[model samples]
Target: MSAIASEVLISRLADWGVDTVFGIPGDGINGIMEGLRRNADRVKFVLVHHEEAAAFMATAYAKATGRIGVCLATSGPGGIHLANGLYDAKLDHAPVLAITGMQETSVLGTGYQQEVHLDRLYEDVSVYDQMVVNPAQLPALVDIAIRTAYARRGVAHLTVPNDIQVAEAGEQPYQLVAPAKPPATAPVYLPPPVRPRDSDVRVAADVLNAGGRTAILAGIGARGAGRLVEQLAVALDAPIIKTLSGKMVVGDDSPYTTGGIGLLGTGPSEELVEEIDTLVMLGTNFPYTKHLPEPGKVKVVQVEIEPTRAGLRLPTEVPLIGDVGATLEALLPLVTPRAERPLLERYQAKMRDWREKMAALENPERDPIAPQYLASLLDRLATDDAILTCDSGTIATWAARHWHIRGGREFYLSGNLATMAPALPYAIAVQHAYPDRQVIAYPGDGGFAMLMAEFHTAARYHLPIKVVINNNNSLGQILWEQMVLGYPEHGVRFGNPHPDYAAWARGCGGFGVHVTKAGDLETALREAFARPGPALVDVAVDPNEPPMPGKVKYEQAKHFAEAFLRGQPHKASIATTLFKDKIAQLKES
Candidate 1:
């Protein structure tokens, strides 16, 4: 609503169980701010400095609480800032209602001051986007947008024109409709797929029966099928490997879980992929295909609820197109259970070995620091129920690998969009939205540098978000990419002019610490997490570390090999040749 006319909308917002909104109020929303004044007691508003942070904060709150996350902004520039953030929410299936103030409805096309078509601008990212130019249309439109956001499980934008917001309304009280939500344990259904008993299921069961070594790779589709996978694993004595996206589907404690495979994966699954006699894939489309052994070694049987994904990647030996849970339930009866193999025991032993090795890697006694060590220390000291939010880039790689998930902690990240600078906002949202849960945000130097100013916002609200800044002074992941690609590592550097992130946090009335070496790192992290309000722990790390389990495309590798074989060592640059020991000797240089 315009600064002059936000009464009814604000009143109705409180009715919708919107206690706290994430946003930085501006001129376009001046009217709404006035309306918000009336709702001070009923609603608590968190005024963030950046619209992107606001959007993400709302998204985090909504995701954690399973409520409609609300963010408000003014039209034109303010609304434009929401593009990247809205995309994150959309991809994550988060329910976010974006309320933006627009120019007067009369001067919209006339290009009046701060005039831009936000409704259209937001259309692509939002499942529902509309301009409420009429005051009378609001009660219904307001109700509809919220409903669409809830049902669609994505972002919805409502652009309220200034004039309409300021216009007089009917004296009737507007009631916000509560969105219906299914309980967490609700049974999800899939369309009945014609899995012929003789053709598909029977064939898949036969493959499982014949295979001496079987492994089931479950994706997000296998979410509700954890128990089924457990039961099936017991029947076949097969281990389960999950994609990063499907991490929560099956608990890590399950004997079937051998850890994730592909990029950012760890544990025995890395080598287990080659040994599998049959790969039974569930509801996943892992991007890397070459990582799979030749089609001959590992026969693939895939079950997917979505029919389109049945034979998506490697052509499936048997495509059982059915709900993941239902398909496993049906197939279990047909297959004969098998005894655990010696190799299975070896694989389990490797998992235990790697976990111990991982702990040592984090608390390494070396002089040159490892970022994984810092993360592990943070992991140990952080709140038991802390919501760990991570940014994309090198820090993301470390967090995904080393940060173990316990029952108390849940992860927050932009899995699809993979945008940076979401860490600060997600941290704010997690703490503000789920005050009960301990929350921490892991941001790379580049990532944290982007939204460093938000520390003031954190201080303003005294939001209890602990930020772990992996300060390598560069986009470490890209640096690794440059090296591995045989390209000269350049343009990824962030020099001394970089903001003293920890100092800035202190300046902003929050806790701050700077650690430059590997020693005493755990103590610093423990102290940071122990602080009451917001805290920033800046730990410098070696940029030369390799991003684990990364692959080289056949085409790219062939081209590079041809170049290198033709005597282009100079052309390969320092990065390409030093993939393994990037920190070797160069540290002395």
Candidate 2:
């Protein structure tokens, strides 16, 4: 008997080195499910509670491993559920393939139950979107889809009809021309890393050498170029400011590093950006143009692998189009090292002062639990090589400011997408990818509640993931935004009766710990980390603790005052908590 098309598809995926798939099974996809079962030894299918979680898992897997991550779902609602996660992958430029099932080809246009126009639905999010109409088309379609996804570094989608999947491989008719040979089998090909032109590199180097004080803004594109960046910074005597997505690329211990820049940036980094004459950007397209120094004030040189991304955020004096590591290797030899070291020293001193100020704020004496203290404690306790995932919100801000990257640690987040609820799925994927390494997820209350069912997914897989919940019981980031914008916090508040996430984790067959006091946080974290399976540690933190901007503009201060005068409930408390320690420093200044 000949193999079914679905079986052939699964075998091809295994050939492409896809050992694991994340998805839920449905009747519409029974043929594909059988294929998975038949190939169970080669490829494993993880059963997630929701299709959305499966998509998120795939995105996380792709982000963690620089390979194509696959996710499957049945037609209609199951396919619809995948949109959010797929969007996450699309925006973040993670390579992923979404295989969604469809009704029989005959029923596709006849208004049948569970029928969705998945091809049209996924078109916006996918780089390659196609539906297999015949059994013979399966192999070629699957091959193209996977290759396109990998080459484009984005989402590829295939909607396989149930009828076509179960059909025999050789049963379908093929169109052949008389006296013509069969088409040659296409070989698997991977895209090579791009290299910048020598002239472009020389121009960028010249821009850097011409400036007295240069600053290097590194992003995720610079992941493998850490040593090169460090060398370049040393040669130029420059301060290195990392974008949030590229925080782990350079270790915090590096003498030239001034930490993250922009909204969740350090004072030293923000000041350095303002004073630098030359700004060299690597691999990051940081969206906040306002946070960057005015274009005319600073000469900009950007290096990126993707041609379109170069100079998209800010005006570039020299756009070096190439892989970050390769471009830096070429540029380093051309640039003249700066002789003066005063600017670098000034920034380093400011960085030290900023760290000391943050240390003071991380005190355990705060009445309501200080998130900074918890983040710092986690940073201290987490393994040196641990992988950390953070959700979008105040927890992200806390992690950005407090989680010290000491070289080996890996951090993942929804960079361009900035989506919420990715922490759990990302942790799950990371744990699955590197079972021996410690994996941690930090999600705020709102983000955690979005995909709370994934706790069961973790237990089912027996994934040993540590999920630390920043339980502020409010959409802390949004609330802060509202206050800064002069709007009263109306819908931002989460009314009492917040679900106990730790208890929910236990209910899902995982260990759980709830810590209400700051003193007990470390103990609870230690206990949770010791669990053999997944564990959740819910720590109650102050909801009013704002993630203050690096530079508070006059408009922001005016709006904040307006909100306070309008009788915002927590305004006074939040204000005192934010500025009390800074008053003495302000007086001295």
| Number of the top TM-score candidate | 2
lDDT of 2 by residue, 155-185 (tens): 9999999988898863454555643332333
Segments in model 1 whose C-alpha atoms lie over 4 Å from true places: 1-8, 11-16, 170-213, 219-229, 251-254, 274-346, 550-589
TM-scores, one per candidate: 0.81, 0.96
Q: Which stretches in model 2 have alpha-carbon errors above 4 Å?
A: 173-187, 579-589
lDDT of 1 by residue, 90-119 (tens): 877778999999987667788688898898
lDDT of the structure predicted as candidate 1: 0.74
What would the TM-score be for candidate 2 when compared with the true structure?
Answer: 0.96
- Model 1 TM-score, all chains together: 0.81
